[model samples]
Target: MELLIKGGTVVTASGSFEADVAVDGGKIAAIGKNLPVTANQVVDASGRLVLPGALDAHTHMAMPFGGTVSADSYLSGTRAAVCGGVTTIFDYPVQHKGETILGLVNSKKEILERDACCDYAFHCCITDLNGGEILDEMAQAVEEGITSFKCFLVYKKEGMMVDDGTLTRLLLRARELGALINVHAENPDLIDLRTEMYLKEGKTSAWYHYMSRPEFVEAEADKRVVHWASHLETPVYLVHMADKEGLEACIRAKEEGHTVYVETCPQYLEFTCDVYKRPDGRNFVCSPPMKGKESQDALWTALKSGFIDTVATDHCPFQSYEKDWGKDDFTKIPNGCAGVENLYPYMLDAANSGKISFERVVEVCATNVAKIFGCDNKGAIAVGKDADIVIYDKDKDFTISVKNMHSDYDHTIWEGKKLHGYPVQTYLRGKLVYDNGNFVGKPGMGQYVKRSHK
Candidate 1:
């Protein structure tokens, strides 16, 4: 079926312009003042904005963490994603200890095949670097459409973390293979030593969790990794960066002509360490914990100046009872929070308040993410692209509540926050999957996207 979105401003990386977009056969057929094409359905977008649907590049569904799995499965997670105007998500395929990358990818593929309400992709996590199996499987995984890989520097004791030497090798190999290397940058040694001291002092509170893993630890690790990536001439992406020093390192690397990119989450932008000091701080606990107000301000500055490339949720969720597990020991709690349904509204609020331009919001939320993940035809409101689009009512105002959320989880960190913008309709491949607070599309309507390495 053909669909026409009339009288809306189309925002993209190039600029925003008032135009009409026509979709036929699941791709954008035309865009201009008068498309001169008939359609089976017409949407009156006169007072709204039309932009590329958000592409969330970081999320976890039914992920195993801290001896328990996340509460939301793929079906629930992607449902929530679509409700927030996101048409696609890129989740991680975590490699278990001693497991081959191929095995991990296949397992995740099976999980997604049964679930997932929206389009999705995967990033292979490198857990064991000692074996040459990773180097061997890299090309096969990339050929099968997984072009990026992630490695951690903080889970050293569990074998999930890779040391500087292993990271250097992986980055060099990825560069040679024409792929991107993503790093979870935080110095485990520094955090462990500080955590031990706090536990000895009987001060194992959530606030201390943030204090122990301070910005310096993240900044130092980021500087080291960016330097290594520069040396190897590899494209590097820093995930969940929380401080100004880390942003400064990325900016410096970029100034030196390296292909370095950084991403920050809403938790860092919306919450502060004070949330940890609350009696119920476990709700806000996450690795690279939320920073002080100063760091938050610096992150906003980085966003405005274009130092930050994207805003991802890192949407890892746990129930409140699970949060209770950390009441006695902070380390026992899962290190994540839920926000797949809040990404668009929060950023829209920021834009409405004059903190960011509408075009910049579209770039960070959609276009840039697609470019980084190698989704060539999925990011813009242009002719010959996939018709994954969003129609947002910019003047709508409402309070965020778990009552209105679509995820299986029971709580929201942003619950009760008021926002001025919301997605009224979302289309993936020119099919109306979500419209006005209801999901009208069927499962399996979304197809897996094979990213190009070009």
Candidate 2:
């Protein structure tokens, strides 16, 4: 496999430069200006940006949720991901009751080995965490390359919530093992109390979903989780931070000398609580629900200023039909939105329009995530790195809709939004996988990437 990407501006986390990149044997062979070498294939990236492929660190493909399975299976989800210029994805696989993290890892890896279209990994979600047996399994999971663990503070009814004491122990264990921890920070008890109060008073609409999990609900949990991690001196990554108050929780943690990484999604940056008033607002229902417009502006500002560490799609795709389950009651709706297919195009579109710099786009979507999650060989465009590349036509425009996207989900909250950039071609490990709206990669074409702790 020999390929050359020529006449493009190579965007990296720190900067951009005009260069020609060479690939051989699924790794970057050389990168230089006017490389005087030949290859079996040449991508004329003239007037386009050849970017390091985006790494979506949050996705839940084929996972069961809310009494039903998420719509997109591994094949469809990963195809959508690569079509959107993402060359890698790290999804969380939940540990069932009585299941060890290593057991869950093996099960998920088997499925991914047969369906994933891009290189993949898992963050062991410790849902049934228990005694020394579980801790021992966690160490084995780390050695097997599942280095990050996630625990939710919400979803108590689903048995997914981790108690404060257990979470503290997990944080300390992670710190001792040289692994990172991710948390879904939301106060479930307050959510339950709020939802019951509102529904009893006839507040059955989608708006109550926002009312139930108010920004302060997440903000308080975010602050408390930081305290837990700080007390244990463990590095923590807060997933799907949606509000200004939550951002401050992270900022305060950093100020007080704790290692904390923050991620906010496009849904939070692009939409707000107003969507709940729309007829189809239930489609936007997710935990840590989108906040008011003020918070939206703050997230964008934080992303640009580097205060926010990364952007991810929490890509737990549920169909429109499945989403309607919560129409009569907000609590019944499946929580999540589909945006893995939107990450690169949206971020690139924003970069083209000056909402963010190209470097920042690379930082949030690719490089920073790799650094945070220990994916050393996966992020940047350089020698010996995996040849995961995206040829983006920065000037080409497209409006987002499910008709053109590859995710199996039926609705996109970002529908009808115009974007002036899209991926024309994508290469995973020197192989032409997606080309101009077609998925050329086969199921199981993707390889499992073991994330080593650095």
lDDT on C-alpha atoms for all candidate structures: 0.87, 0.89
lDDT of 2 by residue, 39-151 (tens): 99988898999999999999999989988999889999999999999999988988867888776778888988899899998897887766567777778888888899999
Best by lDDT: 2
Residue 338 deviation, candidate 2, in Å?
Answer: 0.5
Error of 1 at 198 (Å): 0.9
TM-score of 2: 0.98
User: Per-residue lDDT for 3-69 in model 1, tens only?
Assistant: 9999998888768888999999999999998678789999989988898988888998888888889
TM-scores across all candidates?
0.98, 0.98
lDDT score, candidate 1, position 141: 83
Clashing pairs in 2: none
Worst 10 residues of 1 by lDDT: 440-449
Q: What's the alpha carbon RMSD for model 1? A: 1.2
